[model samples]
Target: MESPITPFEPAIADEAIADLQQRLKLTRYPDEETVEDWSQGIPLAYVRELTDYWSAEYDMGRVCGTLNQWPNFLTEIEGLDIHFIYQRSPHSDATPLLLTHGWPGSVLEFRHVIDRLSNPTEYGGRAENAFHVVAPALPGYGFSAKPRAPGTTVQKIADLWIALMKRLGHERFLAHGGDWGSLVTQAVAVAPGTTCAGIHITLPVVAPDPETLESLLPEEVQALEAFNFYQDWDSGYSKQQSTRPQTLGYGLADSPTGQMAWIIEKYAQWCDCEVNGLRHPENAIPRDELLDTVMLYWLTNSGASSARLYWESFNNPDMAEIELSSAISLFPNEIFRSSERWARKKFLNLHYFNDKIAKGGHFSALEVPDLLTQELWQWREQLRALEIVA
Candidate 1:
């Protein structure tokens, strides 16, 4: 039976571009933060400069062209149009790998690494390490259709992805994700009817075992401090989105600058972009790429719809014990860091674990594609030793 997947390409209209340019020109300014650093939020001066570039210099066509370069398609899964980039490897023996993106990020997060994963030899990687990459836009994100009704949780998205892979002709595959993607990938790893061979994640959504607190390792202590910091200072956005996303959506939907500031602030806060005490998102990811992610939200008017995922699933994450073979890479600046002991508590058959990443943060795929690609390649070797993907 043939799958009902339709080829997709973004047909952004001239008027939408004109409207964005005009909106940028007419953006309302706010008073600068009193603090010197980003203690309050994204600096006003930087926002103005970036928005100006977006208005005058940046090529709006980059978004369309970047996605069009890959094999993008739309398929109806559970009555919603799910958008994804299905890039097959030139290597015939490559395994299928599902890459899911999280909130404040779309499939754009995987843009740099997709080619690296799907076509390894072209980028100096062994053909045996290649994979058929399937990066899907979360429901209500990017070109994917929004959920009009309620109850589109992470678990539902996992089920949808399982069906999507089978429809695409892959019965068994590897899965990798970070942030919200990590949670969905967990669901896929343990979903009852899933065919997942193994899993790798940057963020292991495992809580610290109470027993370990009495004799905490140095890294475990730092992980606790980071988790506390997130709860104290950085979780305001999560609170808003999980509580009243619809109310937050109006501003994000109407003002281009509002949308830009909302998303870029996370990149600055979550990315390992700091140098000599100052943090700038452009240090980790280029300014154009930062704007590229914002444009996906602006063009699709998905500011509110995307936030609702938090409303539906943030408070109710699926944290079941995963017995599947698992590999976890703990990036230094990720929001929550877990030690191998903690991860082993949840991932019973843990195959690989590394917390020695010298750099990179929550947005690892964007900040350090080379390092992220290397980690994936390393994980594949472990799977191969066990014959998980041959």
Candidate 2:
């Protein structure tokens, strides 16, 4: 017999909201950064402004209402209750698509494009292009229940996701992901048990083979340089999360300001902000949308649990090579960019590859939903064509 699935609507107690306000009011800020720019991390002034807005102006009710607008549910899967937003397209034959979010993100990242992808005809597209969307919060992120013990690796999450789709009555589906989610999606595609048709990812994590390193193309060299720069500068959070998430989680769990800064800093650095000549992420993504994501982490107290994923599967050796039908949409402002030559080495059955997304960054769905939506639709057609030929 199948485990029962229950409809769920998240509700934080009044006491919890009151306590958050009291903590925000009592926040003790650190000294201002010696540097003027974000190079030293989120500046004191920027954090202050965000916290002030959060404590005084931001409305939690609005965020909750937006979330409740969707059909949310929880189902027991592999000894844990999984939270997800499952929206079936009106068209009976709509393709089933599973969207997995990464660190510092929740199902909210796909909020803007969910309706459009599920009902393309309403948005100037064909009904045949519509998709039945299933976006699940990772085991320790958003509304999903956090694992008490260790061993919730990306591979394990992929296995759980396949089970989830099967339980929902989908035997085959397409998957898309970004950031750490890309790792999970790739795992799903390659897993022997998965009935996945194909996979799409915003960034394809591929490193040049040592044998091919001697004759690097100009773009490949640039990609390597970009990766190095990320390792040197932007990777402090990853290292810390992977090494000591418990220690780091204390501050994040105790202080909303700390949590906001920790997450917002990534948006400023990883999004299309620099291209738009904006110093902060709010200039690219709406402030409320950003805060909505932060609220998920804060309410669930998932700061540490979410970070544990890095410890479990960051740079796992098994992910280095994948031989499956794959598509990659390369956003220019993304931290790491893999050239077609480099990606082809691993994704041997690369059906679609486009590296010239004029806008967006690491958070392609949130930063450039329209472009990502279009790419997913186009890639679906390409994947179908390949299946026919095969």
Candidate 3:
């Protein structure tokens, strides 16, 4: 596969600076006594502070240079020019693993944890647990071909990643993801293959049994209530992404601040059990770092294509029955979406058993890379042991 010629993207330094100025110039000030708090979105004041940081102190060169330090390459797959970072561990026995990034998130999410996972010894991990990381832009997300058409969905992406692993000469491998990324990895898992030996992830979606929900202890039931609230109040972005992404794109595409505001709310709320989690001081990544996460999307002009994934899936012909089975509730939102029997009929795995990082929010790889790396190592070991014993 031929790599996409790295395009000469506009120097983000002046571009981001100029963009921030435009935002401040033409920005329509919102009413102070507005509807409510962040529930509606990032406060105008909050975004101004963030944009101020972007224009002044935010370091794009350092971030991009750090990204460039890795072996960035482009390859052709099914006619689309794909972009990725290929880092091979020196250890001969290092396992092969593929990591997927979701909406409004670039490969930058994994940048924090790549070395930790690929070189475990330096990170207090055994050499045997090392991995050769394959972090790819979801077809339209990063440097990969941003398909402007309507057909690409998570299923197609899973197939593409499978093909990608083969292209890299790996006959077998494992997968990990979160947010939309988690859903796609799960599809790859249910696929028939010995090569895709085991899959693990932080963002999980599974079915719940109504009878079980009825029988759960009071504490368990509380979590279920929170899950239901998310489906009702917290799903607007998902609904919009699945339906009218272009409309949202119009706003997000041109304005850097708009893009930051669009994704920052989710980063603040979706990764944690509560909105307060976004403000947690002990969190591995601070809110400023979270703004940096949004800037990646803004600088790359990915908000449109990233949100396009929603419309593709929601309109999928196979949408009638999304197969998701789990014996345990994975995310707080899954409780209200499906029943255990239904999920079983759909997804091969039901995760009703764990809340691993049940504390952290979506961008887990970026927010808490150490926690993500350590947990991923443990998951692989558990999967290996289970496969051997079985």
Candidate 4:
């Protein structure tokens, strides 16, 4: 039998906050990057500035406060306590929607858009578009309990999510995700006996169709270039996390600055922050919001535990063809973009294909919640029109 669900509020002890402040106070920053831009990495000057604000000016209680405002809960799934935010839409007939986040992000990524999704009428959206939203912290991330043993792969997480939704009385639900979340969402869509009605993913893990190599469209050519860039310059973190997460964890677990730099670098690199020949994370997400994500890692000391997900699942992903109803959204600045034709090769029942989102990046829910929400709305409308979702 499943463990009884319990309400949860993050009651961080004062000592934890003090310890974080003290760590920030004692941070040993590295020398400034030789280049003026973020070529080498996040500029050391920006790290110092961010750490100064984090230690001195930022409100440490905001993470707990923001999480407390949501109806949070925990339940044992597969012998692990899973933490999640559950919001039932005011519209009783609203479709059940599971929202998952990727690496370097937490359930906090959904903070801006949870209520908007759960109560669409409040945001000038049709009531028909409302969703009974469920946003869960991945195992070993955020408040979710870390796995003590190996084998908690992305496919395993998908099974846990399916079980969690059934425990919440959602027998059939829709799903959406990006990054690692997108992989899990796809896994959920294809899991045996899965009750997932459909899925929408921003990062569909479909390779370029070999057939299209000779006559690549401009979009496909740009996608291949971006993929090459990621392989060459942007994927170092994945390498470390997938291979030596434990070795790297000691510094990140002990130093708040280390954790911040590790995560914030991704935010700057992946966000749609470039303008006028410059890129700044703050250009896409606010400083406090950026720190909000970092705080989730810092407070829980979850750097290593979270990175372990990569170690367990990154090297071997379940890239099976998705036979369920599916939708794909290709934001221009996304790390791995898929052309509609490329996605068509893998997602057999892809009912919605959009590559024209004018803005946003990997962290779409946080970076461009409105656009993401509209995409969800549009995906649902398309699914409904096809009678795939009712």
Candidate 5:
């Protein structure tokens, strides 16, 4: 018999909170970057400021309160207790949708839009757009059980998600995700005998077929350049996580400042933040919201275990062709973008592809929740139209 799903309330022990504060108070400062700007990873000054704020001003109670507002739960799936937030829509026939978060993110990423998506009419949206939303914390991340051994790859997570939805009484569901979650979503969509009705991925992991590369359009060429740039300059973290996560995890696990710097640096680099302009990711995303994500990793001691996923499946050679109906929402500053022609090579039944989103980046769900929510609603409408035609 499957383990019963139990109500979950996240609570960090007072001792842990006290330990975090003490660690922050005793943070050893690194020498300042030689040159100006974030060219040399996270600048010491910025990290210090953020760490100071996190230690002094941020309230863990408030963060916990925000999280508890949602209906959270835990259920055993494949010997792991999966943690998730399941919000049923007021509409009786609302579509069931699974939203997954990626690395450097948590279920907190979807908090802003869950209510809007679930209760559309209350949020100036049509009731027809309402959805019963479920956002799961990937294994070894958030409150989910950490794997003691290996083999929890994206493919495995996909299988767990299918079981999760079924256990929640959703025999069929829609799926959406970005980053690692996107990989899991694709896996779920392509798996044999999957009940995923449709999927909308912010970052579909599709690549150009080498044979068709010679006839690329200008936009396709630009997308390739972006991909190359990421491989060259921006993938150092991935490399470390994939090759020696245990080594890197020592520092991250021991030091709260180390954890904050590691994650905040990504928000600076990966979000649609203007370096010398009026808009910064810190401005686009509230400081408190960013710290809330950092706390999840720090409190759970997930710095190492989360990075282990990269080690397990970063280069897994299992990109099955997807025949399920799908949609892609391309953000402007996404590390890499694949043109429709290239994407079609893998997404055999690509029903909706939009590369014109004006803003946001890798963390679009957090940085631009309104726009992301709108795009998802629009994509759902497109899927509905296709179903009508069928």
Candidate 6:
């Protein structure tokens, strides 16, 4: 349990870096398609700009310093090497908080925000609201070794986080996540009396039944229609990854640009777009945000390992049949979806459901950190008030 302020050791060796650049230089690329500036894949011009910056000026030393500013640790649980940042308030009674990441994302996504959540007073908040932050690189992503055994579902990950918390001396805690993170956090709440006292999620699990919706709100029925579009059209990447991850992983693991293109497409298509990202057909997500995510994947060499989670998740039979249990002992589930208005739909004792028209799309955290941060803080405070009443 050595708590190093920073745990990034430059996963890529110097020789490997040199070799990767050589490969990039010599590798044949697909002929340039339209220069349509991101309705297509990573624009050739934009990618060259990113790769040039990567080769010449993207500072690993500076980036590592930025990342290490918060306390970090490396621990082994379930025979897997777990790398996480555990930052705590100076307060003796600080509440524990665990944050998980989704695919195409790593612990690095929060490198810029972990400190604020941990010591809010220093970062600007009452010391009473301070948190003990635990942001783990999900198993098979970033420094965490990919699972050797298959069937690593959200359930096992929740169990692992409980173990990690107890090992760190936390008896009770709060949790937060988005995208795949929201799903895994749901699983965490399902675990025994580890009792996440309060939980917040960015990605809500509210895909309303379209048929039920069409009659309810005919004028705004398109919102529900978009759900069908996502199931049919937007899920190609998930289908490919879940079905033949190794095939996709081989290309991504080998080529930085290849990996960049693969991930950039998702951000461009799914994030912060107007018109459901499908209705507009032409609204573009900005380049800086896309490259921000790309740089993380490239620097960490986390592409192969990240995809392995899909392979393990898809093939797991238990995951296929598992259902969310309705139990009061666990924390309530929060569901966030992009729709007409921010609404809360509760289901018995199991649902603490709420939604907001947050500023971003799928990768909400990266697409709009300020909005995401505010939303998380607001939700956490709401839960804190509830805990006091209970």
Q: Give per-residue CA lDDT, model 2, range 165-214, as digits (tens).
A: 99998898899999878888999988887898889998778877677788
Distance (Å) between predicted and true CA of 68, model 4? 1.3
User: Which prediction has more favorable TM-score, 4 or 5?
Assistant: 4
119-230: candidate 6 lDDT, tens digit per residue: 6676556666667889998887766767877767777888888888888877777778866777677677667766566556665454454445535564235445666666
- Quantify all predictions' global Cα lDDT against the true fold: 0.93, 0.86, 0.66, 0.93, 0.88, 0.61
- Predicted structure 1, TM vs. truth: 0.98
Query: What lDDT tens digits, residue by residue, belong to model 3 across residues 1-390?
Result: 343434222235676656656664565555653755666666777777777776667665644665676777777777777888888887778888888887667787888788998899999998878899988888777566788566677788888888888878887887777767777787676655535766665554544455566577554565567677877788888888888888888888877777777877666565543544344321445655666667667666778788888888744423223333222224433223333354455445543334534444566677557767777777656655656211
Question: Mind giving the per-residue lDDT tens digits that candidate 4 earns over 44-147?
Answer: 88999999999989999999999988899999998999999999999988999999999999999999899999999999899999999999999999899999
Cα RMSD, each candidate: 1.1, 1.6, 4.2, 0.7, 1.6, 5.4
- Assess every candidate by TM-score: 0.98, 0.96, 0.83, 0.99, 0.97, 0.80
Off by over 4 Å in 3: 1-26, 33-36, 192-194, 217-220, 273-284, 314-353, 356-358, 387-390
Model 6 Cα displacement at 123 (Å)?
A: 4.2
Deviation (Å) of 260 in candidate 4: 0.4
Q: For candidate 3, what is the TM-score?
A: 0.83
| Candidate 6 structure lDDT | 0.61
Cand. 2 TM to true fold: 0.96
Candidate 4: C-alpha RMSD after superposition: 0.7
Query: Where does candidate 5 stray beyond 4 Å?
Result: 275-279, 388-390
For candidate 1, give the lDDT of residue 324.
93
lDDT of model 2, residue 245: 88
Clash tally, candidates in order: 0, 0, 19, 0, 0, 2
lDDT per residue for candidate 5 within 1-390, as digits (tens), equals 988999999888999999999999999998999977777888887888888898889986666787899999999999999999999999876899999998888899898899989998887787888899999999999899999898999889999999999999998899999988898899889777889998889886766779877788887888889888889888899999999999999999999999988998888888998856633558668888989989989999999999998998997736678889988999998877888888898889999999998889989988898899999889878877877211
- Candidate 5 residue-wise lDDT at 38: 76
